[model samples]
Target chain A: MDSSASPLSHPFDNAIRLTGSNGHYQGQTTAPYANMVGPFGGVLAGVMLKAVLQHPQCQGEPVALTVNFLAPVADGDFTVDAKAVRTNRSTQHWYVELSQQGQVALTATAVFATRRETWSAPQTPYPGAPRSESVPAMPKVPGLPGFFANYDLRLVRGGIAPMPQAEARLPHCSDTLLWARDNPPRPLDFPALAALSDIFFPRLFVRRQGPALIGTVSMNIIFHADANTLARQGEQYLLGEARAHRFYNGYFDQSAELWSSDGELLVTTNQVVYYKE
Target chain B: MDSSASPLSHPFDNAIRLTGSNGHYQGQTTAPYANMVGPFGGVLAGVMLKAVLQHPQCQGEPVALTVNFLAPVADGDFTVDAKAVRTNRSTQHWYVELSQQGQVALTATAVFATRRETWSAPQTPYPGAPRSESVPAMPKVPGLPGFFANYDLRLVRGGIAPMPQAEARLPHCSDTLLWARDNPPRPLDFPALAALSDIFFPRLFVRRQGPALIGTVSMNIIFHADANTLARQGEQYLLGEARAHRFYNGYFDQSAELWSSDGELLVTTNQVVYYKE
Candidate 1:
């Protein structure tokens, strides 16, 4: 009578259920890992930051968690919430939700990390520019429909077209070339590789038509530990790249680099893009 | 004092200074001219949606805007503010801010397009795949360190490297044989050709340090107004690509593309990254 070991397998060992604990409101974990489609955007962002650190109660623990998928939760059973209006004592504030049939796909508001962790290093190095040496490669070009086709491309320099204009000025934010990799290999597990590097988007080649943009409302991340040092660069591939990208009025910004193709270096991300092509 | 009569001066007339009224936020601006980061991110997003359509007195007229830059103002001078928290009737909610010496570089929140512009055709088509056919040229690679040479890259296929125990499976995002024009061309405008196509950032490359990773916070864009119909398909090299790059547990996402040179299609973007390498 295991009832086929139901409850969607494990649902986070089924626990953290407190209805209206104190502050951050709405809570319902129940799936450690199952149904997939529905409650997994970082497990509905760890049940909205563990129901906003057990609500209003404040404290500086959960460093960060930001989400904004908006919709796409169809696997089965779910309900993860958060609502801490605001707090201080070091700092704490929450406003997250992740419902299911009842709608509300994704919405977030988290700003934790009142400090502490003391990693050190921001003596200021990322000011701007440096990473393009003749640049030109990027061309394997495949994945269309449901993407993720074992990747592994390279093209060290501008490949096709009458394309040939910018050959001098390289400051305002320029120079770029890449050589990616990720075919089959998995298990690097940094929150499932940061949920697949948050879906990769160097501003999808600029688009705009009479103006109408939407799809990402917020995002923020900052972590360190040398980001794994690319496991000593020898995994065949993992190296990612990008240095600068800035779009004004319509809003958009970028800065990237994540390597490991015998080069090591494994994590660094920054993004702030909002429609304007 | 015309500064040589202008080699492209006006970093914002000399850093805005308006006041009080703002006179209904003016009009007939040719959509802030070609737009893509010029009229100073749309004059601080039209003074934050004209202070939320003149404060809820509820009327409606904006269609889109969603910005966030954290820092990097200094085009010449600074200071721009906007406000209008929320609105009803049709929909309104604005908030714009950009500062320089004062601090807070950038931050925005907009939701315009209250419908009315009617113009259809995008039921979603332009989705093709399998185009390796020839793959050869891609060796320009010489950008990075101040504007990255203004873009003109090349990287055709992932140049093998699976040594360490045959490591292979890297392709979750990266394929850019880019070709962003207007290096010295001149006179295209539209926020300097959208700050030169939103400043290339195909995930970025070369930083190495073991597990390599850098920064990018949040970004989301979806523009496609025939963006000049692929610039008349005169085919000037464009082909930018991406898909499947969702680094969970930590934060990151991907989906990008911009093609030309016979391939047509001209703009696209999608991002979410939170570094750690």
Candidate 2:
């Protein structure tokens, strides 16, 4: 597939497609990205960000985004209102919302800023893993959610598959390392990265070695890469490392970092999820 | 030193006090919590949370808060408008803003939830450190910002004090571990925890062994404790571990975890800060 093909040709582009102007946009949930209960949170996040990015007055690239999932988004037409709440000389702040039938389903706040050269270093060491080419992609399992097929995931460790019964008695570790990219090979962009930030399965599944009813209450992503860096990572697999810090009182928090194939840290994301026992 | 003293007597309470009803509030910046050029970001964060906490419609304890610092808050009276955007059976979402002179200075989104008993565990190991009683509190230094005096901080390791010149050639590490609590022994609460989450100095100062022009652009905190747990904590110190993950271009990110004296995880926070060379 040619990278320069029309945006409608890519499933991701079509899923996040928004139309309207001056902060109001109309979008629809696509079946290709549906989750167990609603659309994938990452796609919803991408839709919210797309509303901002498509706005006429938006400045710079996205540096941070906080999305709060308020209610289950029913499949169909939805609207987004992305407002640039404040625009500073260096950074801009945005308030965005996704709604259906005049009811809010999600609310988000984002920070966008232009970058300049400064003292740069990575304090968090990269979790070294085998090259993407060396690892086989996760096989497409039947009966999985439709969204699973949209990503080419190469699990390196701590996958969601259940451990042996003997090993289940041992301490559980909800950590996962994988190399992932959009299927059909779309170039990397801010929206694509936003969606990829949420590609990991819920930590509960990995810890318990099984699935449960879970929903993310709130998710935050801080982008460490600028437009130039993201463009440099076009169509490349991103190494993702994720783990849970604490799962207490019906909630667990997932912290993950995404890096380019060349070991450049691109983004760090965290989300709090609620689960039923 | 009395935890039950009138709220007006405690500087932290006074710093975050809001006067108003419904979703609107009026607050002032107290001198005790002043930062280099304005109020400390933590106190501003507390003020934002307090607005929602004081609202009559608030349903439950805060689970997550994301504060975006758009402009420098001036030292004066400010108004906060907190709206409960959505309220589900288990969670309530809030959109809050702090404004001065009719201009938005800070905006935040928060999630509050009534948690129930469920399967719970901690995946992230606690970083062991010396007991709070063993380490002397950080002494009050002249010329430091007034907010520094509000927290009794005992440094354990990775202190901000510069390394010896002979050791300066070694690789820089910006990690900090400290025991912290409100000075004068205020009891633990959501507002106090929010303030402590921003207590660490910027990573640039720790890495370069000197101060620079820095400002936090956005901060997110996910609370892992319930109201009962916080009440049990009383005035005990919280062990805080903070470090920078990636410092690139003109921004850097800080990730920190706060734990109770009993080794229970309490809160995890992340923020992206802007720095000028």
Expressed as tens digits, the lDDT of each residue in B1-277 for candidate 1 is: 1122223543322112233443222222222122222233324433333444444343433323334444333334444556544444444444455555556444444443233333222222334433434433333333323333333333343222211111222443233333444333333222232233344442433111122243333333333322244346432445555432334333334445455555543444444444443
Instruction: State residue B65's C-alpha deviation in candidate 2, in Å.
Output: 0.4
C-alpha positional error of residue A193 in candidate 2 after TM-score superposition, expressed in Å: 0.5
* Residue pair clashes in candidate 2: none
Question: After best superposition, candidate 1 residue B24: deviation in angstroms?
Answer: 36
lDDT of 1 by residue, A217-270 (tens): 334433332223334433344445453233433434344545444433344444
Could you give candidate 2's per-residue lDDT for residues A1-277 as a string of tens digits?
1222255578999888888899999888887898998889999999999999999999999999999999999978899999999998989999999999999999999999998898898888899998999987887654568898899988887765532121322358888888999998899999999999999989898888878989999999999999889889999999999999999888899999999989999999999999997
Interface RMSD of each: 11.2, 0.7
| Segments in model 2 whose C-alpha atoms lie over 4 Å from true places | A1-8, A162-170, B1-8, B162-170
CA lDDT, every model vs. true structure = 0.39, 0.89
- The numbered model that scores best in TM-score is 2
Candidate 2 CAPRI level: high
